[model samples]
Target: MNSLTRWVRGPWTNPTASGLLIALAAIFSFTEGVNPFSDGHAEGAGALPAALIASDLLMVAAAVVAGTPILIKAVRALMTKMIAIDLLVSVAAIGAVVIGQYWEAAAVTFLFAIGHALEARTMKKTRSALAELVAVAPDVAVVMRDGKQVEIPAAGVEPDETVLVKNGAKVPVDGVVIGGTGALDESSITGESIPVEKGEGDEVFAGTISGGGFLQVRATGTGADTTLARIIHRVEEAQDAKAATQTFMEKFSAWYTPGIIVLALVAGLVTGDAVLALTLLVIGCPGALVVSIPVAIVAGIGRGAKDGILIKGGEYLETSARISAVALDKTGTLTEGKPYLTDVTVLDPALDRSDVLGWAARAEAGSEHPLARPIIDAAEAEGLPVHGLPERTEPVVGMGVIATLDGQRVSVGNLPLLTVEGIADDSGAATEVDRLAGLGRTPMVVTLDSRVIGVVAVADRIRSDAQEMIARLHDAGVQKVVMLTGDTQRVADAVAAQVGLDEVRAQLLPEDKLTMVAQLKADGYTVAMVGDGVNDAPALATADIGVAMGAAGTGVAIETADIALMQDDLLKLPQAVDLARRTVNVMRQNIAIALITVVLLLAGVFAGGVTMAIGMLVHEASVLLVIVNAMRLMRRNEDQHSAGPAPASDARELQTAGAGPLS
Candidate 1:
């Protein structure tokens, strides 16, 4: 069952079917044209009519072969009462054909085919963001076996196996470089344009292109476990999970068709004219109403792609407009997620920053924590030498560490760890700690012989565009903005204020976030939850619309979310929302136009002011006009990213008021 499902869902699902339909259309249209066009009366009225008929017929056959199975399935499900509205339109078109209106039937079929083709093309273009990632994945990898290079499949390379990556190839998996130095284009993973340089021990993710020189990296993951595969899967699922909006035409199509048929019958009985009834049947098709929403959706999706945003589908684009509040994650969603060293304090005046970091790095050399890597990395970058730890060392869970360095007892950890160990019970250390924490920094205390020493502050930087993006959301009619984070309350509050958010829910566990989302939903708010990856999965799943930062977001988060922003740009959130709202507006506009056109045509037909040929011409022209208007959505994307200006400063108001520092 799984195998069959995979096969049907694969790329081959509609290609063969579309090819056959196109072939049939070409054959039929050619047959219709052979007799008249060959007679050499090119300027004759018959010639133009015959040529148009031939062109339309050929297009119909092409579209059917390309999309017939899917359309057939849609129609069958509707007829079987699975989807009643679509079934009505399908039946009406068939009725037109059965009553000797072959031209009308052919026109309807051809238009439907073209719309479906446009939809398919949009999906393909949107998915190319992920497909490009897959295309760059390494096929054959160089693995180190017994200190010699051996060719092996990327899938076969196991964890900790050193693989050589040369110039112009993608990194096979997430891993650290062990040899050589080079620049790497990690834009596929981080959405940053600049290619970053990497040396030994620097981490790289799969799908990043290698630059300028060879490097040997130890593979940390592979296959579905690779970062690229996870990202691709997340994109695919997010696009698929977003349910489409039911257009005005689609919702009323079933009953509307029958109502029109009845109206036509009543008119014929009252006026004794059969031609008027047929004219009513031709004018009442609702082709414009049907085409409105999907066109806007396609345009929105296409626009997103151009601006480095890849919206999965039409549903997500529509849902974004309805969002009243947004839930944001901390680590990767707002901050850089990459920790950097900011300041290092020394307990002893004699011991400078360099001396303290060197001692701390040596003690944490064997630690596997993410925090530890940056400390050791900082020490190395500063050219400070590290020595092996002394006689005793111990780790205090959720706190700092205690060890002997240079025959003296040295302690490193959070403030709680220091207090518990009976160290640095002083006012100066307390003041410094509070100062660092207030800036949304992570402070690490270093003590010597139970005496107050200095502190090291590390922090993840906020994205440069975050402040402006939040402002745009408000301008676009978002009622409220909320931030959810697992960080300390102080840090959470600071980030919230900086981003112009209305509320901040700090120190939330994964389950706590889910509970909060439920509370918001119960209050009837249309909430959009945006997150990076794994930690945000629960909340993402619970929100009205789950929007994942696809490239950096985890597989679970993306799969759970309703929308995936491929570029991982926070600014794209506002752009998507505006795009959706505009698309909906366009759909409404098209519907109004189509309905007015139908009503006017029906009145003229019943009054005998319009003949059958004139009615058909006017009706067809209206459909074409509705279509052209909807296509405007495809072009309106240029305005989605019109960010006014960079924010002056989030801290400007506070600075001017001389406000006391926040705790």
Candidate 2:
């Protein structure tokens, strides 16, 4: 019994069968141009001028072939206590048959079946991107177990196992290259066309193909824990999720289908025109309108996933499109997050660059601070030995470090550290610090026994694509690009100016960043915050959209961020924004197409021009038009980064983005 119910509920309807039946019906009807809707009634009971019996038999057969599934679906909807589109199509087809309009019944059901078949085929194409992604999942792995290489299923490999990836082979797991070297075609993971060089200690993900060279990777994650699996899972959930407009359309379809049935019944009772009433029912499926928003959203999100941008769902996509202001964290996002020794300026003239750098390195030796490494690294690079740790190292939060070396007080810190130590710098050292900071270099003022010696500056090099990202944000219709950093105001301003940022919010801690985002939202700006997705969690949660950069290795980043750019490339941020805007544009276009088609069809049905067959034809055409329009998003992306300024966003729907989903 259960098997029978399931079989009946499934897509048991075959449009091809109906097509063959309709062809025979059209041939036997002997009407002009093979029109099936024409009745071939005989002049007399004994006469055979019309060949009426044979024609009616073929038409009824076609109607039964097409309408069986519709009736089954309509019966299921009745059991579920709902008024579905199938119910409307079934009722109209049955009504035509009751009134002896055999050809009309066959035509209506045949057109409806064909429309569904076309939608199923085209929508499958729209999802081709995701299907391609799933197809890339690694199937086999060569693992070094018990000191011998053994082949096994990809999912059977255990964590921490060393997996071998050969040239032109798929990487079987997300791991680190502990030995060997290779380049990977990470286009599946990062959407980068060029294969990335992977040396010892470089991270590699599953689903990437090796271009050349062999690599032995120690797996960090296996099976569903892999980044590729996570991406596929996220995309599947996103496609199934509904957008705000799609939800509204569904509710509208629910009542609208029933209302059409009610209107048809009233029209038939008042005017006694069964054909006109049946025509209304035939056109009242809401086929295009019901699908307009979701098909656009699915295609758009699927397209982004192909490019390694993972948007959470419809709400984030919609909100991302309205992002007028973008807030960015400084470290790791704008810059490389690794400060390097850029300059060493001597203020005392008594000592050279080596004296200043040597003292700074000795003072900061073995220090874990981000700035300490650059100074120590530079001193060693110039053959200056930094063998021992400083005797005493004091790290002042948000200020530079002060350490004691060889019992001589050595201070290597920003200008504020001098004030904190009550030390005097009258040797023109502040002027040198200003000079270096003005050029976007973070200057560390060096002091020896309360005497200012020289200033050694180390700055995190801005990413190569930072400037391009800022410009592209503007081109994508973002009105403002702001920098929020814990760096001092001078350093922040310098980086901001070089990047052409619209605003800079410096000296902010993690919580302060959240307050700033909330302020932006309260000011009626749709704000998107881009960060590392961990330290910036508060701010990211408070913004309209939270974008995680370089999220390939970070599972939490991929899972939690509203949108995750798999690579560290800054250019993907602007590309994501551009895609979101394009997606919203497509959704609105589909909506407009659906609404216009409905209005036109309704007008045609009420006027005397449209028959039941004509109404079904137009209805099917409109549904196909909507599906075809959405498929445009799956086309190859244009130059989204350098495109002209985009259309202004609608802030009304996204006003409370920081609070929750699109209102």
Candidate 3:
């Protein structure tokens, strides 16, 4: 069909045509002194009565223009052996015209047509978020094909191909940066507005816009294999999947529509009252009941997607509403995953602070342990000389490293390594190690030439918003926030105290973490486990909800995690929970409104004061009301309240309040 023809035949099309025809008909009826309710004659032999004839003709034309599509839909539905609301509406309008109620016929068809158009427009607004996402999907990509840059459809880009993305261009595939650097705005994928810096080996996702830099990315995924595609697919499935209440309503509606038609037939035949039976058919369309849950689900899921929270489905939303306890993996979740040098204590007065730090950095120069970077960074920051790797280095599996530097023995590790090297703790180095460990710092004793020199400590700094995030989780109805880590008891206690945790599980291996999560579930707690490492995978899977933090760049996390918080912000956890609770509340309210409207309409129809036009109006209004209620979820808060950085004094107070007997 041509565009105009298709539009004219559409359910929501050409409302202005129906509206203009109705207006003309009303004006002509008034001019001829025609009372539609009084069976006024349009065939009287006079010029004045001719105006009445024009009014009746106009009304019939308006009814036909607006009601033809509805009749066609009714016929198609009948061919399939099913009845629909359009069928009910068509029957009522046609029956009214057969009885010479031209005004009623025109009014009912016009109102139904216009209401449908408004409903379609409003529903599009409710789904605006997903539409916005689809709009940003990249259409083309620039790839280095045969060493020459060529543009191709984004879906046509082959895996492992090097794609070039310039400033302000949307990335066309999921890939890792192999050359150059750039900042990418990943808000479409992660809901974070900030542009994340990308460097060599950093991951980038499709549909993310590059910010002010050139990048050569090796495409790992394109088209349907990309993370953005998966997210969109998941959201669509979530919105389409019927909730339990919706399924029940659907089952009720399946019988309700046909039952209403049967009742209409019986009522008309038994009472010989055609108008009353037509009124019954119009009122019994089940409009609100059929639409109540879907609108809410679409709006709720769309809102979450806009905020960078991905709910698996409506069923998950229901489950999320009851979450009481949250278990968090310490590393990369509550703390910055990167460790930094915090304390450098001198044990030997002969050796200066720089000497101890330089010796430790030199010993760790060739090491690949995570803690080594901070020591080297600190040394470099202070302009200390750390030129070359050690001539010979021996690493103890769980202890530390022993290296021979410049013909002298230099060791950097825990006390166990020092003991293995026969270094005595006579200088009270053991006490200092204990003190640092008690303060949640990982202490490494430095020894030179078989003599204890000093101690260097590194600790993962707690995120500035960690305390406030826990506080907000409690406010959001979370009963307890537990800290789980492989760190020692003292370190775990220190962090737990700082973050206001209700419980702490320390020195837990990967399997131990899993056990703790299972234990929480066994204790009847709806647990949400938040983590960001491979070791956490087991615990994350074991929890009721697996939330992956800083998941924007990780395709696996985005696809697999039950709830993936795109940013590393601690506050998103509570925010996700709060959103789930709000969505569930909206769903319940919509269902209640829908059921009540159905009950009241049915009662009004049986009580004998309702007419066909009024019944259709009430039914349409109820559907609109349910839809408007669902659209409320799409409304963003004017002032988004986010957890800001806490002051230094607040941190001190938290540390004091959380301190244990050791303090």
Candidate 4:
């Protein structure tokens, strides 16, 4: 009894079942040779056969079944003082029935009922991409407490708790690996297909799957504070937000529906043709125009989330489509931020490479300078003996270090420091320094008291994908890609040459980057600045769009950057720009479809061939077409993760077709 009541109150009330019943009634009415019901007009009711009476009753019963929901919705909308499409549909269906057009009323309501159900089902699929992210969130956790492993809800794990993750288990929190080793499939967080190896001190994120090995993670964030939670939240908010085009369409639809009603009333009063007026009302529902932009935005944003690109909202997606110039912060954006020792040259006749390295390491011992560790690590890597630090050391800002060793003076820095200390480099030290700088290295000339001994150099590693990213940016329609760095001109130029960058501005301060961005805007270019989000904050804020890479862990990065890539992958940059352009293209196409559909529909209604039933059929078909068109965005671009760039010919075709980026 309970199950029957539930069924009666559920699917039976949905109107889809009513559509099925109406379909059966139509089959019996349309072909009088088959089934018990027969078609007949109401003009000769007294002389009607049993078949004719039964057929009319069957059509009327199906009409009531399908029209009840429309009538109820119309009443609710009227109570709120709103003129909804449901009200228009209800009035049209009732007028058809009053005129003894049972076949027309039944067909109109059945088509609407089935269309609504199909629309609801397809729309749910558009949101499923983001829903998959929320579904991957860890539900269970195993934490080590008081020497015992305790199982609990993932949210119950407190901050700083040491959680144990084994092979094939989902990581339950955002944390640092404290012990053990593992390879994790981090695709859920980063969208990278490969498994990343994690050891002690490596960072891990929630919702990542452990592929092999075990790990002890010290949790820093759990539950709602995890990166997975933040991504899901951002995507949900973005899908709900409206674009400017969507807002305008909604405003137009609000007035369009009412105008249709007024037009229908006027036509009926002028021509004294009730049927013609009812057909106009049915066709002028604004069904397609109302949904065009919103569906596109939802599908587009949700697709981006699945690929680990987080757009802030519809507004940002629209703005990104106009990007013509992009500036990158050199240290972390195009190169690995960590400096590594690349070269060491010995110029002194008395000492070899080991002697020079040992002296540099001893002087740099106990130093906190950024370049010190690379030199020290390189010295240790060569199995050199590095003892105690110099008794006293002084680091000159932007020059080098000055230190005092036993009974002597030792210095390691640039040639500027040599000149500042009144030490002359007569053994072609200047030539050697220039040679190292030419190779993109920051050379430090080490001097033992007054003698120039050797020069040791360190440089940040260029990312393997740097050149590919540059090429892809051009393929995506970016006019310029500039690299901004605080390094010397030689080092910056070397990197720019290797990466094929269009422009390189070297030796720039943080404020200087902001000035460059503003200059791009002044030149009529829409700019995007990719940076680490700290020193580049001003420049990022000044540009039309700011993109942050490796943003999975930082809340500010995910929230503030216009486009946040969950992983530190350069390929994602071009993919993001291409996606924004494609989404904007889809939005424009949908609007065109909606407008053209309405115009053609209006023309058909006045041409006298379109009846009430036919108008409703076309109206539902147009709404479905708009929705299905938006769903195309939900499909993954297979070439998005491929190594190659989009074809130049493809871009040219898009431009010619008028279906490319907005600008």
Q: Across residues 1-663, which tens digit of lDDT does each residue of candidate 1 receive?
A: 699897676555455444444445445546655332122222245445554455445444443443355457657775676543233335434554455444444444444444444445545654455566668676778788998989887788899999888898777777888999989987776555578899998887787888788888988877678766766654455445423544435667766876877887787789876546666765676666665565555555555543445555666667777888887887777666777676687757788888778777776664544666677778989998865544677877777677776688776677777777786465376778788777776777777778766777666667667778788888888888887877778777767767677888887889999988888889888899887657777888788888877444344443445666756577778877887788778767877887898788778876667744355456556656666665565564555456543644534111100011121
In order of appearance, the predictions have TM-scores of: 0.70, 0.91, 0.86, 0.91
Q: For residues 159-237, what per-residue lDDT tens digits would candidate 3 score against the true structure? A: 9999999999999999999999999999998888889899999999999999889999999989999888877877777
In model 2, pairs of residues that clash are none
Instruction: Residues 230-342, candidate 4: write the lDDT tens digits.
Output: 88888888888888888887778767878999999999999999888888888887777777787888888888888889998888898898899999988877776777777
lDDT of 2 by residue, 216-239 (tens): 999999999999999888888888
TM-score of 3: 0.86
lDDT of model number 2 = 0.81
Give candidate 2 misplaced runs (Cα > 4 Å).
Answer: 1-13, 31-35, 40-52, 391-399, 402-408, 416-425, 641-663
Where does model 1 exceed 4 Å of error? 1-244, 305-313, 359-370, 423-427, 550-558, 640-663
Model 2: how far residue 467 lies from native, Å: 2.6
Q: In angstroms, how far off is 15's CA in candidate 1?
A: 24
Q: What overall lDDT, based on C-alpha atoms, would model 3 receive against the true structure?
A: 0.81
Off by over 4 Å in 3: 1-10, 14-21, 24-28, 37-109, 143-149, 156-164, 175-184, 196-203, 210-220, 258-272, 366-368, 647-663
How many clashing pairs per prediction, in order? 10, 0, 0, 0
Model 4 earns a TM-score of 0.91
The TM-score that candidate 1 achieves is: 0.70
lDDT of 1 at 83: 44
* Candidate 4 residue 83 C-alpha distance from true site, Å: 3.4
